[model samples]
Target: MREYLADISRETEVWTADVPTHMIHFNGDRFLGPHS
Candidate 1:
């Protein structure tokens, strides 16, 4: 069910790099802003 999938997603550990310190510079000069 959707609730079960949601629970699994919530409990999962997703690995990602920490937000870079210069991301603001990159955002201004490169990519768009972060999204929801």
Candidate 2:
């Protein structure tokens, strides 16, 4: 599932949870980070 997400991430926006109160947005248009 992880690899699958990474593969399709090239075209769409993917969001994953890093912690109870943190979120990560993966995309090709910008950098990485904990948006909140």
The global C-alpha lDDT for each of the candidates, from Candidate 1 onward, is 0.35, 0.57
Q: How much is the lDDT of residue 35 in candidate 1?
A: 56
Candidate 2 pairs with clashing backbones:
none
Q: Please give the RMSD to the true structure for each candidate, in Å.
A: 12.3, 6.6
lDDT of 2 by residue, 1-36 (tens): 454554663458666676745555667246554555
Instruction: Please report how far candidate 1 places residue 9 from its true position, in Å.
Output: 0.9
Tell me, by TM-score, which candidate is best. 2
Tens-digit lDDT track for model 1 on 1-36? 323344444434433236643222212322334654
Candidate 2 whole-model C-alpha lDDT, 0 to 1: 0.57
The weakest ten consecutive residues by lDDT in model 1 span 22-31
Each model's total of backbone clashes: 0, 0
The Cα error of candidate 1 at residue 27, in Å, is 29
